[model samples]
Target: MSKSSIYLPAGFRFAGVTCGIKASGKPDVSLIVSDRPLVAAGVYTTNQIVAAPVVLCRSRTPSSTVRAVVTNSGNANACTGSQGDADAKAMCAHVASLVGCDETDVLVMSTGVIGKLLPMEKVKSGIEHAVAELADREEAFFAAAEAIRTTDKDRKTESRELELGGESIRIAAMAKGAGMIAPNMATMLSVICTDASIEPKEANAMLRRVARVSYNRVSVDGHTSTNDTLLLLASGTGTPLQGDSLCLFEQELTELAIQLAKQLVEDGEGATHVMQIRVTGATNDASAETIAKTVAASPLVKTAITGGDPNWGRMVSAAGYAGEPIEPAKVSLRVCEELIYENGTPLKFDAASLSATMKEHPQVNLDLCVGGGNGEAVYWSSDLTTDYVRFNSEYTT
Candidate 1:
């Protein structure tokens, strides 16, 4: 698709620039500003040891409106103690001064190496340059997406336009993530904007629900980052959405989030295949998700898929230990359309054929039925490869 297809919602401007935080000297800073106060809500990483920016953002999230977001990639402002906290506040303060808003009206996010301090001199210069270059255009949005990347192979962006209350409304989003991914949020940063008018209470509720099924259902290496943040902003520049229109907007938002989440898995560090794990027949949705996550996060299962080996036993074993009761005789499993296990017994199937099928497709489907219950859930994960090990081993260098 054309890059311009990822258009920003009305009244938003974006800029991205290099701040010398990355050794490669790629763009490492991004600023997003709204023309007016917008309803905002955010979901952050649940990690106990949060980054400085996470702490700052969490403190201001109680407010109903926000005007700007400042983010940087490389040199995560984490574990610097009081200094890190001060630096995070300074970043917001700088943005607020330039945008003519209170410090609380701006949010900050940073990602990259942990336990390092931010280069305040470079950051100040980068923020000033970014603010000066801000513009409402596709190129600006693309730059903002690119500046938020640390190890991502590609920039992730999505947009949708729909008519609400006889007026056109647009929703656009951009995200950065490749590794350190798991449930309870991932090692990622994302910003979503819409021109539809929405109240703060309703917007927050909608974002939480959307995240549970999208960002919360993806796993790369079963690791949650300290800097994960997902923010949603509503500019109120379009006709107000109510009742069915609000529901429609939420549905579209969920779809867009899912699209970006899937992209993260597809672009996972050294990932060759994306696995869609669907668990059904459980006693409840929670049980189903627990089983699916167990299978999706198993290293053995991930490695088997990476090598195009149709080793269904590993998957079955992972599901059994998901802390949920399951009858061996009632369990059934399938990889794509080929049945590998039934009635708790391994079925005779052509291993070569299944392996070939896996090699031919970038996506692999694993369906498991544990019981006759009505609960069902789905999760996405990436196969583990040798390169994933090598890259992370020397990431500090």
Candidate 2:
């Protein structure tokens, strides 16, 4: 989508600027500020070893009076002990002072290189410059999106508008991620802002519900990161939504989040194909998700996708070992809509044609049916390529 067409929600200003934090001299600091206090909610990394910003932000979220977010890239500020914690708080303190709000009213997020200390001098300067340049324009939002990226080849963003109570409500979101993805979410960081009026409780509930099905359903290399965070802020500039309107807002929010998540997967480091896996007929949703995740995380399955090979056995074997109860006689598998196996037996089909089809499509769909049960799940993953391995091998060098 063109940057000019991107929508900017009411009551928010954004800025992204370079601060000499990245070796490449790219924009490394990003700020999101609201003209008025707004309700805020967050979902953080499930990884026990979280970054300092994650810890600081997690404690103060689901709040009704948050005012801004301060972020920096190229320094994750993780595994740096108490000093990292102090730096995170200091970032909030500085932004709070500039934004004219209490320190706790600001949130913080950081990504890139773990176990490195932030260059405080550069960070403080960056935050000050970012705040000074903040603006509520599409260009500002685009800059913020670009600044937060690390390994991402392209910025991920989406916006949606809906009418609620005869007033327009806008939702805009930006995300950054290209690797370290898993079911519990990964190194990804996302900020979603809406002009609709919402209570803190509802905002928190909706963020978690949407995240479970969106950010938490994608995997790149099955390695969760220490700085995954998804924050939602409601400026309440639009009329309060109720009943059907509220449901519609949540639906739109979910769709927007899913779009950003898929963008992250599509931009995975040197990725060529996105694997869209669907697992049905499991004992429960949890079981279905486990099976799907197992297949997504399997190197053998991913490699087959990278090579455009219709290796149905690799997928079937991965599912069987997923620790879920499944009867082989009741299981069926399909790749790119072509049935390859059914009811415990391999089906006779044109392997060459199916392989060609897989190579021709950017999204390879894998459908697995274990039994005629009600449980089902969908997951997204990127095929593992030689380029992915090469890029990550020299990531820090």
Per-residue lDDT, model 2, residue 225, is 95
Global Cα lDDT for candidate 1: 0.91
Residue 137 in candidate 2, Cα distance off native in Å: 0.5
TM-score of each: 0.98, 0.98
Cα-based lDDT for every prediction: 0.91, 0.92
TM-score of 2: 0.98
How does candidate 2 score on lDDT? Answer: 0.92
Clashes of each: 0, 0
Q: Write the per-residue lDDT of candidate 1 for residues 28-112, one digit (tens) a residue.
A: 9999998799888889999999999999888877345699999999988988999999999999999999989998899999999
RMSD to the hidden true structure, all candidates: 1.2, 1.1
What digit string (tens of lDDT, one per residue) describes model 2 on residues 204-308? 988999999899999999889999999999998554577898899999999999988999899989899999999999999989999999999999999999989
Off by over 4 Å in 2: 1-4, 237-239
Q: How many Å off is the CA of 111 in candidate 2?
A: 0.3
